[model samples]
Target: MGVRIQMLVALTSLLALFPSLTVTVAVMSVDLGSEWMKMAIVKPGVPMEIVLNRESRRKTPTVVCLKENERLFGDSALGVSVKNPKTVYRHLQSLLGKKHDNLQVKVYQRCFPEHQLQGHPVRGTVYFNSSLETHYSPEELLGMMLNYSRGLAQDFAEQPIKDTVITVPAFLTRQSEGQSCMLHRWQV
Candidate 1:
């Protein structure tokens, strides 16, 4: 009983010292990289904690698979890449906001020759071509990934986490492309 009282007093003192540490709701942050994505969550009475995926991994591969009518994300999608190279999309962060003629897009094309990538007829930007005969823009693909990450965060928090912050790769931010989505005003 004495230890419990002391612990409560310490917690109260700590909360008084750092008011922000007393979080009442859960919030999540995602680091969306080219090869992997990591998520962290902050909840009441807890410090920032890495949100693990279903596989209990701190990070998830940044890959998505779109086959027929089904779509897969992360490792599940990566697992199917060897069998269906044309349907699985990898390193999508590199393709984000790139033009069809951009040097980066050229590099992406060379990296994944198995999949067909074409310029959007109107946007003149990169669009992925899969066996589904449907074209998906990088923005759409990134949105799907963000959604996937949200699911992971939600599962870990065990509550609906509506507040989320997503950050892109450093290279993406330091790129010379000015006509791209830098996410300065974009909110998750």
Candidate 2:
């Protein structure tokens, strides 16, 4: 009983010393579909939903590209994929999780590994362009996209955002799959 009391007193003292500390929570909502990637920033009291860019626009297509020059492209890689459909890459969200196996992604003519590439397989891995080209792991691609989304949220908040809460769809099952949705609160 004495030990518990002492611990409580110490905690109280620390709280008193840091009484001005503020705990800010951020929620990044991401929804990646075959056609578009949508994200939103959520705060404790804010009611605005901000759309993110796909590299150069207000939104990014749920697409990717594998360049022969060892470059991975998102939607901007679309042009290249269009010119050389065999080299450009796109659409990988549906390949993750339970939906990965015994499934077909005809909307985008690309293939993903049937097994887990990283810790999670919900985001699934893909090959972009030529066989010799360097392919991006699903985690890396999702990380880059979410990182961009976090940047946009920081710009909107106009403050250094460290604490955040991210929201994802119920079906996502990859480590990085839902991360892009939580770019702002990734640290937590």
**Against the true structure, whose TM-score is highest?**
1
lDDT of 2 by residue, 1-188 (tens): 99999999999998898756677766655555555666667666778567556354656665555445554445676767657665443445554432223334333333533222222245444422233434444444555655655666667665445644444445556565544445434654
Tell me the whole-model lDDT of each prediction, alpha carbons only: 0.77, 0.53
Best model per lDDT = 1
Give the lDDT of residue 135 in candidate 1: 79
Write candidate 1's Cα lDDT for 28-108 as tens digits.
898877899999998877889998987899989988888888989999998998898888888877776677888988888
Worst ten in a row by lDDT for model 1: 176-185
Give the TM-score of each candidate.
Answer: 0.77, 0.52
Angstrom error of the Cα, residue 2, model 2: value is 32
Q: Which residue pairs clash within candidate 1?
A: none
Candidate 1's displacement at residue 47, Å, is 1.5
